[model samples]
Target: MGTIKDDASLVEQALLQDEESKRYTGDGSVDFKGRPVLKQNTGTWKACPFILGSECCERLAGYGIGINLVSYLTNKLHEGNVSAARTVSTWTGTYFITPLIGAVLADAYWGRYWTIAGFSIIYFIGMCILTLSASIPALRPVECLGSICPPATPTQYVVFFLGLYLIALGTGGIKACASPFGADQFDDTDSEERIKKGSFFNWFFFFVNTGALVSFTFIVWIQDNAGWGLGFGIPTLFMGLSIGCFFLGTPLYRFQKPGESPITRLCQVVIASVRKRDLVVPEDSSLLYETPNKSFVLEGSRKLEHSEELR
Candidate 1:
């Protein structure tokens, strides 16, 4: 992996890495370690598709779970709309909040690749469990007596919610990392590469919709008409394929190093602001703190410039 001098501060270290990356390429590229930044100098399109494909299939698997869940609850377990919808809404809330935890951890410690990979594995296992819960006669919901369907037993509730939460945890982390990791493939310093990054995001959303469309039309239909085994199994297969696709681009993909913790930085800002609340505002723009280097201003995104907005 690439690195800067140990003595330098975060901003300086980032600046040096940026300069080194741009300046050092080809036979003249990269100093000290002598490793090339691009192994085959592969273009962005080639490397990015694997990630895009992974996300597409991932969405197919995830949304496949969502599209017909109400029907599964109502028809199979004889749950009312209010009850099933409430359960699903609770699960959805957990799925959304878990991503924030994942993002914080990813920036603080794990690189995007590892975080996404780890969470994906967890997600796959969860999907498998879900399939088993649906397919196995013992694990699945029982038919209702007349119009009244008994609530799930503790054992059944535990088994089902466990699998659901695992998917949430895995997809949450994957969601935070996937786009930024894909964007990392393109060289921001190059205008062409930047444009390619923008294009990747556009297509990324397109693929998401494509997955949702297939899920609603095909996966939902399969669950309705075919056996639940086949319906759930299809998305599981897609997820398996998605994981395989992500690994295929390993050689070509550019891996990024983890940096300073966002959690800590946020704490510092809040704490400092509260502590200095009584202090007089400085009129001079130059009095504000900023990195010396233009190249590496921000760790996560961009460097902030001293401006009238502060006043």
Candidate 2:
């Protein structure tokens, strides 16, 4: 009997140690299958290299196209300096602005992973079209001598601009979600992981600049020395690789579930505030309507404690 009791206590202690050593994250992030993740098995530095690779390759492709686009417009498309500048500026604006649409989709409906994946496809298609437009003789204006160059036909213009705008739309989606998605890999509740999250952003920026550096120097050299086809094609390949890296990391990713529309929440808050405008303030902030649960009230959002300063 004494031996049995000793063995039972030893087993209980081992179980207790296991439980203490392994704690799940308080944040509502789950694995790809919508199951709770073990900190030891998934996320953190393990998943970062893939995310960084995706971002790096994407920036390489994006910046590669954007940097020399003005020259492509003037020399290849036969536009004047002002026209080329204006066109590039317009496209850049579109690229930056498209993120708003991506943000809404990621936050309210699709979440980050799917948003990035979906947009990457669009981006890849655009790159392919752009490469083809440069490579195929029929898609581009004829090469000319001196200052006299043949103007692009309507069809040529349509093809080139179609590719360009598709790239803009796709990049918007990628830019909106990539950073947040990377950040999601780190558990916010864990102090060590939180520190790593901050480090991830630092390295993220570093890799972004690294991509741009390669784009500016190496890709521009290729565009100038080699033909436009190869220049565009190489970046297209990089874009494909970016997509590959992202998908490969999918198994390890921690997906933050999409939440209720923030816009709807804001509208509700406004309506409620206006309706209660005449009510007296409660001295006890505990009377305010906040969820009792310590965990997330919704997948992506936590209930904030009521504050007097905000009122």
Candidate 3:
């Protein structure tokens, strides 16, 4: 009986120690360092292939569209040099500026997944419209009517410009958000995974360039010989496939709610400071009585106090 009681106490003590150790284990809880490590094994690495695949496909489609866009606008669209230049400028400006908008939208409203998916649909629609405009001569009359009025005759060039603008809007959204979205997938808290995340950007760019190289070399030739419809159509097909591929890994992708950007936070701080400056203060306050003075021993402290009083 004595031996059995001693053994029971030993068992209880062991159980208590086990529970305490688990509670204190650095890996088991939600500390900043531990959270990331815990998430590392939660299927993030498996999702990387899909992200990389989407990146490659996006680059391919973009390059395919780019390599032939000038020629398509000038020659196939049948525009004068002046008209083509203006159209190109408009298209380029829209393409560049819309990305900033897309980034803001992605961060503030849409998560990366939704942003990519939504923009991809828009991209597909834009590609379809471009292909349709290039293929069907009859649709050109309606589409180009605005560009071709009494002052300016409707031209295939006008249709091309409209199509290019739509494509720009779509591509801008994707370009701005996709990479950052992909990076978001890796759990950065784990040291090994953090290293992998760092490596992902490099690999992402490499694959994108590879896709671009292929598209520029081959897709351009197909467009040059096969006709505009087929040229644009190929990219449209690839974009669709890319979208499908992205969706395939949706379950594996980790999402982060967009937060205020550093610039935005800085701007907010500045605005708040300005507003505070404009605030009315009670006349009798001790801060209102503070004065600036120069003294070597306490000059810095005095200056800070004076500044705070002014604020």
Cα lDDT of all candidates, in order? 0.78, 0.91, 0.69
lDDT of 1 by residue, 48-160 (tens): 88999999999999999877888877776566899999988988998888889779777778777778888999999989988887888778667777867777677776777
List the candidate numbers ranked by TM-score, top first.
2, 1, 3
Query: In model 3, how large is the Cα lDDT of residue 285?
Result: 76
Each prediction's TM-score versus the true structure? 0.81, 0.88, 0.70
Candidate 1 residue-pair clash tally: 2
Per-residue CA lDDT of model 3 for 234-258, tens digit only, reads: 8888888888888898766666555
What is candidate 1's local distance difference test score?
A: 0.78
Error of 1 at 102 (Å): 1.2
**Ranking according to lDDT, highest score first:** 2, 1, 3
Candidate 2 on 1-311: residue-level lDDT in tens? Answer: 99999999999999998786456666778898998888887889889899999999999999989999999998899999999999999999999999998988999999999999999999999999999999999999999778679999999999999999999999978999999999999987778898999999999999999999999999999999998999999999999999999999888888889998778888999999999999998997676756567775666865554567957
Q: Highest lDDT: give the candidate number.
A: 2
What does the lDDT read for residue 64 in candidate 1?
Answer: 95
Deviating ranges (above 4 Å) for candidate 3: 1-43, 140-159, 260-264, 272-311
**lDDT at residue 266 of model 3 (Cα atoms):** 73
Candidate 3, position 252, lDDT: 62
Per-residue lDDT, model 1, residue 205, is 93
Q: Please give the RMSD of candidate 3 to the true structure.
A: 11.7
